[model samples]
Target: MRTKETVPEEALFAHHQAAMEISVFGKSMDVLHKEDFLRNEEFCILVKLRYLLDNGIEEYAGINESIQLLKASIEAKDSFVIIDQTESRFRGGKQQQFYQFVEGLLTDFVSTEDFQDRLSQQLRETLTQIKTQEGQVALRNYTEQLQKLAERPLALKLLSLFKSYNLADYSLLRQISELVQQLSKKDVRDYQSLKPLIVANYRTFESLGKIISLPPQRSNPDTFMRMTQVLVLEYKYQLPFVQLANLLMVIKRWYQPYQNIIAVREQYPPHRYEQPPDFQTSIPGEAIFLKYKTWLTEKSTGVLFLDLGN
Candidate 1:
């Protein structure tokens, strides 16, 4: 049995940093493309609640009372009640439950003022790094666009929340929650707006790839290449099945040129061809030559179609 290898702390930290950068870029793209400000509003509320709870604000207790009222309203439902009232009760119950859950999380995870301060500092440092990174011009531009969009009252609430809680951390969690909701909704039109962002992100990765090193025998390069290709296909085409089928077709075409070489080896068997070829003066000898060629025809045929300008 193969044992699991332990990663060095430095390598682990590097990996984490890379993943965090990618995540920031991805969330910025979502904010640019989705145009759903309600998510930001909800996030601001949650952060504010966390701040109030941490600081022992007296008004925060009113939220618990409000939740109790909502629960009572839900329980008071009767057949005589209109459908709209019942629906409102149901939504109220859900909202109360969500607030309670978030409150519990804040109490458990971010209980101390010192820890909250540290988290806020880390978030600020991370954002500053992202903004100042010389190679991340596109990401910087996207961040500017997000700031412009969030200039309204709802965004002002976000700023107020950030004054206490951590904006980057809260935004990351909010984006994750919203992404889950988006998946359930299956709205392709919103995703269509992400095409340019995806392409720009890919270009950013491509530039990073030039400076990164990998073992020559390892498959990491090909794996990352395929992942980028799939992202382009999924976002650009807006149809997963069609793009995936085309990807498989590309793999098949890549393997086609080597099939005859494999067939010849199988037919002759390895033992028969194990003898070294002899080159001598005045001797005519039988020789078998294996040649493999790959054509750009597959690429020309447009297996991966993308218009980055779009």
Candidate 2:
């Protein structure tokens, strides 16, 4: 029996690791592609042009002139050189015509306008597309169900935090649903049994947040260290020592920098800056615990307990 249970647990763990790797890879690729696009002169021109159009700047002459200049710069293999040379020419007492023209084009392109109509149009298009997609209907229904289930005062508070921080995910909703189902199956349940499950669920969200919000500069060990400290403090009394130790080990492994720490430190020394104080209550674990406590208190009546926990 032990072996059978352990095998499934190990398999689930492996599956989770694989999913994390895929998520990381997708995020890295997105960052790389964005950097590449930003560096491309054509892409830069189009983005500026899109901004102009979105802002209702349809001056044909200004737009055409700007496009020609950008295209010429691209052909010369140095788009930024035009901006640099134009500035230098102006300072050298040469003709200011080119510099003024380019400057005006850029200035007018970014000038703001009321974008309410454009925003409304975008929303209508999005709604139309969502209505056409069959899967989106199901997704919307699921979201509605989640919102309803989250209406309990305790759950509402936690849900609001999760939404505010972009911490909520489909997996979290699924986990909550499963927990509720398990509780329903029990012949007798109480605060003690439910408390551990809530803690476990919150811990999962904390772990996911740490993984998803990993610093771009992985050489910075401070984030991982802070995560370790919080996890240890939060779970030390609540969980078995062995389990806590294993969780810490997992965090340490995930936090390993892609680059060597020695090399990174040598390249970038510490700066003399005042660091912000760490707020312990802001951590998901503490917030979730407090909300759960509030929920327990609010539903303390024996009848409420009998319906849900008994």
Candidate 3:
């Protein structure tokens, strides 16, 4: 239905507007895409229609006429009403529950264990393909481990949820990636928050083992990488002042040679190495240098600075 016959111009515009609103609100696209509000249905539709009208892409048409036309179509018995199960509620009057009929079909289809078996098999095959050398070793190893764990009945039963709920999509992968990245960066302070993501990632790896051998990654995981680096820094630098001072000293010494190297750029810039004029005199320079040195000393702990030999 999402990509069948071309949606009417009005409906397509409405979908775009609604999609933007839902995304901004951080609501589920699935829910907002198929909602059927009873009281303000026309009003909500007109809001989207109005946006299209003012945008000058399409001829501006007043929604009052459209509503009347729809009402007339219903009176003539030419239009049909389609209710989605997830969003609409029927009072169950003389009207047959349109929502229930669809839900019934879905429930029957999803309840079958046969489809689950096929899906699991498909997943396993997909997972094998991901294990190629082009993929990350950590992800490959994780998938392999999952495959072994799923051999157990209990593990298989629990993992059936991925097949049962049918959440194996880009969305699920995105969520899993987020959870994993968060877990990787977190200090594991409480340990409880860390456990769920760990367990879920393990289970997801097992389920993905059936279909995808390669590990999933963010479209751009640079942020995740930087965050993980900070986590590494924190873990490495969690020490007393004495040790941290020694660490800083080692880093400063390592950078000293490069820092001292002069660039052979056409000419040397004036005052490149001299202290500021305000600190040129012995007394003033001594005072300013002490202040600057103290500030640098305070800032240097647990930090690594690099000189490009310029």
Record all residue pairs in model 1 with backbone atoms less than 3 Å apart, i.e. clashing. Answer: none
Task: Rank by TM-score, highest first.
Answer: 2, 1, 3
Ranking under lDDT, best-scoring first? 2, 3, 1
Whole-model lDDT for model 2 versus the true structure?
0.32
Which lDDT value does model 2 have at 283? 25
Model 3, position 34: C-alpha lDDT score: 20
lDDT of 3 by residue, 164-208 (tens): 544334343444445534544545333244444445455543443
Candidate 3, superposed: residue stretches over 4 Å from native: 1-171, 174-193, 206-310
Model-by-model lDDT, in order? 0.31, 0.32, 0.32
Residue 4 lDDT in candidate 3: 26
lDDT of 3 at 147: 42
Residue 194's lDDT within candidate 3 is: 46
Task: Give per-residue CA lDDT, model 1, range 1-310, as digits (tens).
Answer: 5443443455345434434443443343333332222234322233233334334354443233222222222222221122223223434333334323323333344323433443344334444444334423433332333233233323323323332343222323233223333433333323344444335444333322222221223223333332233233333334433433343243333333223323333443434333112111111110100110111112454322211111
Residue 126, candidate 2: Cα error in Å is 5.1
Task: Tell me, by TM-score, which candidate is best.
Answer: 2
lDDT of 2 at 12: 38
